[model samples]
Target: MLTVKPILPRFGAEISGVDISKPLSEEDRRAIIDAMNKWGVCVFRNTGLDDESHIRFSRNFGRLELAPLRRDGKGRLAHRELFDASNLDMEGEINRDPSAVMYRKGDRLWHTDSSFMEKRTSYSLLLAHQTPKEAGETWFADTRSAYEDLPQEMKDKIENLKGENSLWWSRKLAGADISDETIENGPKAVHPIVHTHAGSGRKALFIAAHTKDIVGMEPEEGRRLIRELIKHCVQPQYVFKVKYEPGDLVIWDNLCTMHRGGEFDAENEARDMRRTTVREGTEPNSKDDDDPFTELFTGMPKSLSRLTAPEAEA
Candidate 1:
């Protein structure tokens, strides 16, 4: 049996007492689902879940979204179901690629997982494999609460607006020179800005870094509104940070929350994280893309440091 304790007043919960590595018992599975339904984010501390177990645990809930392929056409991780959300290169060394460092910076922006995918993701389970000495907490924003708190006029204004989410757009914003061919090859998903969350029957704002523009409106006007809503949604009261310990797994509903990576000493320390995402709809919408570009999003600052170093510049 598992017990769930609420970590925040309205959104997060901590669940304990189940060995997440093994096949779940009916009681444990039901309890986990119930907790997930009520709490948008659930933290499991020290459950001892390895890569295989992590993938196994996720399957009990929904189908796992395969990790995007690397530049070599294979997932960087041993398993395609596991996303390599870390600062290490494929060889487990600090990455030295200049363009890749910039692409990784995109994760620092607040966004939902898989929003740029055609079908979108329902949930994301992020597990910490290694932690830096300090800083690097992951911050989450309660978008469901943000939507409810919206002014009636604002709600009416965005009632029918749909946001076009693009991985290329975010990469460019983060200063990555993604080739035009790569941009044209990636996913650009469209979803409603004011979405009625099917699981909770609550409304949530769907704005994020990946949101390039709102569909069917003048681009600048739509951008202004998106910015306004994001500002409101990420107010201090609606946001919280979770500092992870090794083996910690935090699961959050992608439909109702937004998250950003906290700053870390990227040039010196290591912070290795992995994730498994669950697809939203029953039917898969698009082909699995080999996203060696953005899949490499993580901390790697050695090259960036040299660019700004006085000795290197002069």
Candidate 2:
């Protein structure tokens, strides 16, 4: 039997009584999923899962989407199916590369994983392998609760509106030096500002930092509205902060929440985390006139040209 206890009144729960590294019984799996649907986020302590087991556990919810091959400063894939969410380089040491560090800075902004992709992500499972002694945390906002608390008129105003999201735009905001071509070619998606959950039939504010503007609204006004909505969504009551332990694993529903990485002393401390994302049921609505850059860089970086190149080549 599994045990679940609410961590916050709004939308987070802590679950125990099962080892996630081992295969789950059908009953246990369903129970976990149900709890997640209700709470939007579930935290499992002391899971201590290896990469293979981590991937195995994540697959219970839906098909495992292959993560884009992201290289470290040395141009090496960190893990096969996991998105490296650490401050470390490919060699297991703290990363000093300027580009990698700037890229990581974007995590501090609130956003859902894979929102800019043609295939939106459903669930995100992040496992903490190493945690800093102080100030390294993840903050999650309950967009479902935020949506429910909205005034009827405000809800009506956004009920049918779509918001555009772009990875390049977000990275640029964080001061990352992204090339113009990369911005134009990168994945850009449009999603409903107010989305109804398929399973629970509840609505949630789907806007986040990845959201650049509303589809039909004036650019300045749309950005201002987005900023206001984000401010509203992250109010104290709707937020939950998790200070990770080495073996902590948090599974969150990307459909009903947004999260951001908390500030930490990256120069002195290390934080190692890996994430696996499950794809959403419906295809995403992309704004790009042609296939996004994600397709071109699916398995590896496009600059690599061919995978058969000698290992010595950069």
Best by TM-score: 2
CA lDDT of each prediction against the hidden true structure = 0.75, 0.77
Model 2 lDDT-worst window of ten: 305-314
lDDT of 2 by residue, 1-314 (tens): 88999987968999999988999888999889898889999999989797888988988877556544333323334444576677876567877566666666778889887677756778889988989999889999999999999999999899999999986677677786666566666667899989898757899988888898899999899999999899999999999888899889999998999999999998778888888777777332212233232353553223323322111000
List ranges where model 2 is wrong by over 4 Å: 70-79, 179-185, 282-314
Residue 240 in candidate 2 has what lDDT?
83
Against the true structure, candidate 2 has what lDDT?
0.77
For this target, which candidate reaches the highest lDDT against the unseen true structure? 2
Predicted candidate 1: what Cα RMSD to the true structure?
6.2
Residue-level lDDT for 291 in candidate 2: 28
- Reference-based TM-score of each model: 0.86, 0.87
Model 2: how far residue 51 lies from native, Å = 0.9
Inter-residue clash pairs, candidate 1? none
